[model samples]
Target: MVDATIGQGGHSYLFGRALGPQGVVIGFDVDEKAMEKAEERLKTLKCRVILVHSNFSQIADELNNQGIKGADFILADLGVSSPQLGASEFGLSFLEDMPLDMRIDKRIQRSAADIIKYLDEKSLADLIYQYGEDRASRRIARFIVQSRKDFPITTTGRLANVVCRALGNRGKGRSRIHPATRTFQALRIAVNDELENLKALLDSAPEVLKRGGRIAVISFHSLEDRLVKYNFRKNKEENVYEIITKKPLIPTRQEISENRRCRSAKLRIARKISEGD
Candidate 1:
């Protein structure tokens, strides 16, 4: 079994326990902190746990390096972890005045700050529109460009402020979500190249799985969900996959009431279908 994006080993823990003493679990995570935390949690498990401090996009090569041909099960959770969002080091939350880093993988050269500082207004606007699905991307981009001229938008707070001002904040009680939410999401995705990595993972998953192996993906936003949805559908047509969840499975109401963040999550599962099938 392979747990891709094993943030804090939450999913891996259940998988490890289920596999018991006979299974081998390989987990991949780009964040060093998450890897360490998962390692500590998985230490007592009976299965052979191999944690890789790398992106799941490199799953095929990593498995090959371990003398593993294919996995029986693979799972990937595409949502940013709570720790990553809450920690100042990750720079994901606009609620705090943290430095605009937002690189889950420290090895990545460009940070959110670098992206904001370097990209031209048009490119930045396109990124916001494409990644964030924000309609006011042009206005936000113009505001950011203008704001940078004054003192450089260096912190999450400053960027958030700029976005709010650009969008004209709806006072305190009127708005449900932050005005800067979409822009911040756009920056984080751009900084991490998340969609591209997801694409790589989707492409590699089938090749790295044994015939009839199961694969599951949990995506938070429409962008990620749509990608996974269409990819699995296409693979099914090609006889490369058998879609298990014809429609995505979402969190139950009780689950969402307990954890509001899980409200947007959508789970899709598929099984590998060899040519014989």
Candidate 2:
């Protein structure tokens, strides 16, 4: 068993509980804080737990280093942890006035601040347009570049304000979500290389799973869901895997009503087929 994105040990604890005497579950988390908390939480569990402070994209390589060929089950939940958003220093939420630094791993050299400081107006605009699917991306990018010329756009609130101003009044639709929503998502994805890592993980998963092993992925946005859907469908075409969920399984309406953040989550599951099949 593997809990990929073991944020604060919520999923890791669940996996640990399911594991019996013969079961071994390894958890992966990029955040040091998450690892520390998960380690403590699973310490009293009956199952054997080995927590690694690393990206889930490296799960296969990590297991290989330990001479473990494959896993029976894997789960990846792709959403920023609550702590990451709640912390002002993380700059994950535009509501905060903290520095625009959204690095999941402290070791990563590049950051949201670095992209803002270096990317040209058009390049920045394209990133938001392509990655975030924001229609006002150009306006936002132009405003950001212009603002940075006179005063460096350092904080989340400052950037959010600029974006809102560029988009005109906070209309009813705009009020539904924060005006800076797309910009923050774009910056975070760029800072963490989220999509690319997921793609890499999808490409490597089949090789790291035994026959009939399950791979479940929970994605929060369209870009991620698209990648997961495409990979699952593509692998099914090659007869290497079977898609368990033809349509993505989403959270219940009740779940969404209770936790607004889970509203956008889409889960897909696939099982590896026999190599000779």
Candidate-wise lDDT, in order: 0.90, 0.86
Q: On a 0 to 100 scale, what is the lDDT of residue 136 in model 2?
A: 87
True-structure lDDT of candidate 2: 0.86
Each candidate structure's TM-score, on Cα atoms with residue i matched to residue i, is: 0.96, 0.96
Off by over 4 Å in 1: 169-175, 275-277
Instruction: For candidate 1, report its TM-score.
Output: 0.96
RMSD of 1: 1.8
RMSD of model 2, in Å?
A: 1.6
After superposition on all C-alphas, the RMSD of every candidate to the true structure, in Å, is: 1.8, 1.6
Clashing pairs in 2: none
